[model samples]
Target: MAKSVNQATQAKAKADAVGQARALAPEVPARIGSTPATKFRGNPEIFGRLVEDHDKHRALLAMIEATAPNDPARKALFEEFVRDVHGHAAAEEQALWSTVMRNPETTEFARHAVGDHHKLDKLMADAAARDITSPGWLTHFATLKDEYLEHILEEETEQFLEAEKVLSEADQRYMRKVFERRKKAEKAAAVIEKKIALKPVA
Candidate 1:
């Protein structure tokens, strides 16, 4: 409940800051730590849905960076981001990237993305060890942000395009179902892990 209130307050503060900045310059990107608005939708299509998730991840990362480490909001937001990253990576690997890998034309790109997920999982494990408010945690978070940004940019620029070119409408419809199913399973597992981790030591 408190976390929800904090999030709402923080979002309002961010919006106000952007509004003020726009009133001043009217030309620059809205404000510090703001991400671009998403152009994707809720329907779990291969490209658009993935892009939507990426946009939300970017927004959550930005919010996490903007937050003070001591704030409860920071920890809450970071946990959400972690769950999202894990679920999206797992599902994309099982569904979208696997399909892309089958096409000789996109095999290399698919492999690169899968390799990133492996490296990122390792990084996430390390980040999970640090105190939310500690300097080490912030460093880990920043590094994760950098790597995530690069991966998403690559996907936006090249990977999804390749998949679209190689995949038919029917193929995407099937892949979308698989992606949604896999994402849900992974996300549920993430929630369970979080719950178990938070339980008092026996």
Candidate 2:
């Protein structure tokens, strides 16, 4: 009976973990009012927008991973992922994390979050150095995807809450405007970069 009870508990625990992870999984935005033209007016709107970006990043990473390394399309997909991830990180740093770093208590967490971006960029660089068909490239990419998902979870659960303690209502409203504006500009720049990348070398 004890053994059976232990087995049941383990199964329940696994189910809970799966559910929590799914809550973070990429999907159609449960977050409303985030249509392409929607402008974030406050902190809650900003937070929702960030979550939507996170969802899309994860979905893209999964799609890339599913494609074999030898597939011709892999490079283009990876390039898209790079643009989105890098652009999001840059804009978030400029608009959101900068404010978070202002608070003494949140400064360390903010720095760590930024450091994760550096680490991810390095991982991407390592992957780019290899033949996409090689096992080494896939290994690097898998590690990157795993770490990227963890970073997303950390930002939502830990950094955002800590930062909010230091941000005033007015600050949040101002930051929301900045975050949305910067993200739009970043996305436009990324689209241009993607087009350039797709262009054949002369």
Candidate 3:
């Protein structure tokens, strides 16, 4: 009787240990932090989605800018869109694109993105510095719009789809989440910017 009790206790202990180990083990690759480079790297498909969403934002900006700046509501909306665009681009540059550039597989795509980034940087700076109502503002905005769409098309057709081949299913899912989160963040930033623009400056 004593021996049997000891055996049962030992078996229970072993089962509990196994359960604990399993609990501590990493889950499937679908989760955001499952891999290192995935969490920090740019997946072109995801970036393309980001661009699509951004284009919608640009459209909104153009609409609001077309209105009188004294129209508090339109002005606010425009400011919000600008803030969102700035935040999204800044985050991608800092986290995704920067890391991807280091990998040999992504080198050429990264270089192209970097060059596109330079053009975008100038466009953004020029737009931000100008009087939103200036005659040249629309032309500049239109030029930026064309370049933006072209870059996005290149990423979608060539870079992003190509990169997908190199990633695991889990990493791919993570990329989806990252892109979704970025979209949400940009939208939120736009709202906040609009709110701020509504307030009378002290």
lDDT (0 to 1) per candidate: 0.66, 0.63, 0.49
Query: Candidate 1, residues 65-127: lDDT per residue as tens digits?
Result: 766667777777667677878899999998888878988998998999899887666666666
Candidate 2 lDDT over 14-68, as tens digits, reads: 3343333234433312221122211221114455456556756665666667666
RMSD per candidate (Å) reads 11.0, 11.9, 18.4
Residue-level lDDT tens digits of model 3 in 57-153: 4345445445543444443444554565666665555445655667789878868866776666566555555556555556655665567656656
Clashing residue pairs in candidate 3 (N, C-alpha, C atoms within 3 angstroms) = 44-160
- The order by descending lDDT is 1, 2, 3
Candidate 2 lDDT trough over 10 residues, lowest sum: 33-42
The CA lDDT at 156 in model 2 is 71
Q: Which candidate is the best by lDDT?
A: 1
**Better model by lDDT: candidate 2 vs candidate 3:** 2
Best by TM-score: 1
Backbone steric clashes in candidate 2, count: 0
Better of 1 and 3 by TM-score: 1
